[model samples]
Target: MLLALIEDSLEREGWKGVSPMEILEILEREATLRRRGSITPNDVRSVFREVKKARETPVLETLRKNLTFALPKLPVSRHKVKMEEFIAASKNMKLYSDQEKSREIMDAVYLIRPKETRQQIGGLHEIKDRILNQISLAFNPRMAELGYDSNCRFLLLGPPGTGKTLLALVAAAENNVAFIKVRGGELMSGASYHGEPERRIKELFGLARQRSPCILFLDEADAIFWGGDATSNKLLAQIKSELSELTSKDRIVVIATSNKEELIDRATRDRFEPHVYTVPPPQDDDEWNEVVEIHLQKIKPYLAPDVEGRKITRMFRRERILSPRGVAETITEAHRLWASEIAAANEVRAATDQEKRTVALARFRADLERIEHMLPAIK
Candidate 1:
């Protein structure tokens, strides 16, 4: 009740116009008239401080908005300001010390509100369903009522460019939650001072908890958990503690991706057991066709009309462009080559649609040949 009153006053008069003493006096008067328990100035001030922090802390504000979406019953007011806007405001407010820490945390962690859905992911239908189901259970309020385990930890094992990152983004987006991505190497590198890495791990998990119904993606997990040194062991211990601390009520799902699975320790790997999934490159013609078509559609506007997508897909397959990333890069490089030619031609005369289409097809074939020798053949 006191918190509501403080919030109301702050909303009406702004934080500058409100005073803790005034709130204390109001509480004291109510207590005296009602013959209730005595109210102390310290009590009123403490509540006031909490309200002040909620309003000032940018991360809290971000989490509040996320909570408002996840749990409508919560009485958190919506803020028009974004996370970056709040950080900018904090700079002028001379809250540099706190803001600096927040900025560093943000720098190490990449926050993404993903718009990609499972449908956007070409193949991996079984993997997609499994991930979505796990995240759905984690976010479902009914699961908590039924005493179901809602917290999940996933370790995505895959080679480079196998779309592990995309899977994580899609899971968050499908669940209508925030995605916080942290590279293992980057997180460790930021820990220049003694115990800084452990501190960062705590902050990262703390932030994830605050932003419940979120996906905390740790990319390149090998880099952080691979080392056998004292620092690596300490960092690993801290991460284990954080993961173990997650309860069913916390809607945070941790997804760690690693290309070098051998580097991860046994204990660290066990933390994500029963949920570990290996994401492989496109294995069949249908998957390749779909993935190739998806990438082609993205660059369709720039391609020549006569450039056949089917031919391109076959070419990708023949050249062993197995991974989705490899296919996308091949397409992108081909487009870049064609675009450059068009730009150069514009200097003399604007190229016709026919001319552009011919050049685009040629470039696509040329890039395929170039990368055929460059790309390592899948063993």
Candidate 2:
């Protein structure tokens, strides 16, 4: 709590230096005013020293830590030549006047590697196989020459948090193709003021065409295609028409997601033909266990080292609440409680590993009760 407060204060003041003693006095005064237990001046000094040391680290080092891959082991000359060749190739591609717009659009989407293969994706194995095979067939020129449709356009209908978005990233990673993602609302918002939306949509598709053998994922697709009286909204009609045209392009696989499949217009629905897969939430005990295990693994690194996944899985199985999102939220809430416990003990900066594990487990058990209360009623 003190470190966070100090960090916030530093940011607010534009990082102009503040004396450790001055901060200690201010915190002591605040503690008195709030009738909370006071922190020792020694602890305050320790936190201030650590924060200062942290600030001395270079920003580039922090960024390097978050990178997925290390720098290539190529000679500088060869690397420079490769970069220049890539730049030249990009320039030679005649796509649009403002190609950066499409680049910006692609930048916002997350590029996931194929760590979670089709088998690792809990349930929906058959649907996963269908998607994987479709992508393979569509990308094969021989299949097209043999009179196949070769259009890999698909509509993934599912409830929220059923991994529709994850599947798109998985597909892109599986095929080693570039994944270009855009939300339906972004298109709608762009279409609102001027005719720019339609032009932008067309340009985006053109960019996708330039980068063929890529997946173009439209998230929350129903937002653009859903609603009463499409003729009443010119923006909606225009955007939908643009999407309809864009999906027909070959080698440009389009995957769209919708929570409410019924709301999508028949015309738009027709475009994503013959492969509309429904991804429902985990239902039975086995599926729920898988969901629990998947999320527990995701959050395991953030929690105490000694905290076992099996224990958490057993507890989750014992509970009545079992949404994939709900499990994640519950675990997150437990971590928050653990942080609070550390803060209460006044050893947030110097907490021992054993202390952290004990507090975290206690908090996890407590939060499960809170989560049970928060769970939605079974319909």
Candidate 3:
């Protein structure tokens, strides 16, 4: 009842959103509800102050973000912002003093790249067109010339294992900007000395600004930004808070991805309107067929004869074409098997004094057939 009264007081004050103090209060309440130990008062005081400073920190940093999507759209010229300026600006904010933690974050950012960068990233012609179109439409006229508008916010929603995260890496590489990725599970830094999710959220946005023009991609976006998870409300608050600040005058941008859209908080959903949705490789979509072919074409040349035989045989005998991801896996497995067989054949030849390519070829073919049976049928 005490907690309810406090929430009501905030609501009555027109605090439609949660504030740093409110968040701290909620954390204390939650700990009690769960019968967990209480949050330390010292930690609460420290993190709440950090939270206040984070208020002025930019979230959108670019006019193209969803927070400002309703504002007049403008044409964006092609230009990339320099990383140095971004880093210098972050230092001004004094957000990241822990260089070690920042490096760890950056590593995760790089590691999130798609396994097949060339094939997946380069082949996204239509998607690129859509993304560029939005960037053009969403930028501010003057900022576009200054490269601020070049930073864009995009929300990618689609089936599982799709290259949503991979697309982020490709975009970063193509634009030559830092790629930073944050997942819902890893957002917390074990609570500050104050136990608020405050410190990490502040650090995250600060890191993003430092890496401005960079891709801040999230894998399970719904988990972080959706309503219903009292835990997620903190992040949801951070998103609105950041975007509001970024719109005033900054060049940083943000992009997010989620497989489940329905679970997203209304505020987050509103912010990502007009987002691009990535559909799973269609059952019979011609475009998907072409993408599949292109992916296979690139991998075909160096298939190592044994792997080439196994994969090609499976593909030719079966009617289904693998998703770009699936095809890549199939090729890798085929290569390993082929390499093993060649090694065995070379060893046997030392004793038998017989070098026969025909027998080896037949064995590879049989292996291919076995592989064909193991693959699940794609619809």
Best-fitting candidate, measured by TM-score? 1
TM-score of 2: 0.57
Better of 2 and 3 by TM-score: 2
**Residue 156's C-alpha lDDT in candidate 3?**
82
Name model 2 segments beyond 4 Å from true.
1-116, 193-196, 227-249, 299-322, 339-379
Model 1 weakest lDDT span, ten residues long: 88-97
Q: RMSD of each candidate?
A: 14.6, 19.2, 19.1
Report the candidate with higher TM-score, 1 versus 2. 1
lDDT of each: 0.69, 0.58, 0.50
lDDT of 2 by residue, 266-350 (tens): 7777767787788877766567667666766766767667776566766876784555666777887787775655454343223
User: Estimated TM-score per prediction?
Assistant: 0.67, 0.57, 0.55
> What is the per-residue lDDT of model 3 for residues 1-379, given as tens digits with 9 covering 90 to 100?
2233434434443333344334534544443343322233333333333433343235324544546447553333123322232223222322222332443343333222223343554244557557644543443356656655343557787766555666666555554444566776565434434425554656566656543444566667776677665556666787767655654133444677777878877777666556646645434344455554555566576553554333453563384544546655665675667666555445434434233444544555544444444432300
- Candidate 1: tens digits of C-alpha lDDT, residues 166-260: 88888888877767888988877757778888888887786676455578999998887765889888888998899888876777889999999
Error of 3 at 168 (Å): 1.8
State, as a TM-score between 0 and 1, how close model 1 is to the true structure: 0.67
Show the colliding residue pairs in model 1. Answer: none
